[model samples]
Target: TALAENHPNLLASRHQLAGAYLADEKAIVILKKVVEMYETLPEDHPGRLALQHVLACVNLRDGEPERAVAILEVVVRNAEALPEDRLNRLVSQDELARAYLNAGQVKKAVAMLEDVVRIRKAQPEDDMNRLSSQHYLACAYLAENVVEMMAKVVQKGPRRLVS
Candidate 1:
């Protein structure tokens, strides 16, 4: 709790502690507090979406997949609404897709990822946005192991990303 005392609003530290506690049975209170802190933050805050993703992950680890799914759904909706920052939205979408996978909503995860892949593919090859999308999509693909596709995705990292 030293980190929390020093930086109460620090999202990453809170998320890390919650993640650790989630593996134990004594985590509900800590996780709830972390979620509360994050929930009060403005939607567009830098760590807002990341906090939500962590909360959802904690919920999943707690065997509360329904709650995790609900949180992720809202995250995806919010992501879709933020047009000025499409890359941020994409990151949220990627997190939501992972939530879906964790909740065993495989179909939803695949469907969401299909769109992510399409959008990434349409980006100008030299754009960082395309590279990020590819990175996340590749991660999702590896998570699902979609028919030996990992080889193709694994090979594209440095190539897709132009320094």
Candidate 2:
């Protein structure tokens, strides 16, 4: 139904629907359309980032981390420069870090995740987000064999329950 019309309001919803389509054929088609719509929008338009994020997720799920990384790099770079959207910038950075990890760019992933941890920590003390980002950063450090960084992050997080 979405493929038949280019309704601006439906673009976001279609992107969500695309995620449920396990078959790449349908998903890619819908995603491509969404990307096209986003491309036509202003460069700073939030919808562009949202569509790009969705496309990156699809790429990652399809075993195309490199492609995901490409999309997220732009998203992260632009989001980071937007001082008004600090939270969006941090979230985009977090996603880009995950994409970097998937692409085996461990060093870049660690750096980006570190920034996320720092930014989250500076917020009004949202323990859950702080701990989640810290945990992810710690895991990234572990993957890179950087025990020191992993130890620092783990120490800052809440103690785990011993079974």
Output the number of the lDDT-best candidate.
Answer: 2
RMSD of 2: 8.3
**TM-score of every candidate:** 0.54, 0.75
Q: Which stretches of candidate 2 lie over 4 Å from their true place?
A: 1-6, 22-25, 123-126, 146-163
CA RMSD of each candidate after superposition: 11.4, 8.3
Model 1 poorest 10 in a row by lDDT:
1-10
Error of 1 at 161 (Å): 50
Using TM-score as the measure, the top candidate is 2
Give a tens-digit lDDT track for model 2, residues 1-163. Answer: 4353456668768877887774666887888877887787777678888788878877877889999999989887677668732767776777788888888898899998887887777766657667777887987988898656677868877465232
Name the lDDT value of residue 97 in candidate 2.
83
True-vs-predicted CA distance for residue 162, candidate 1, Å: 57
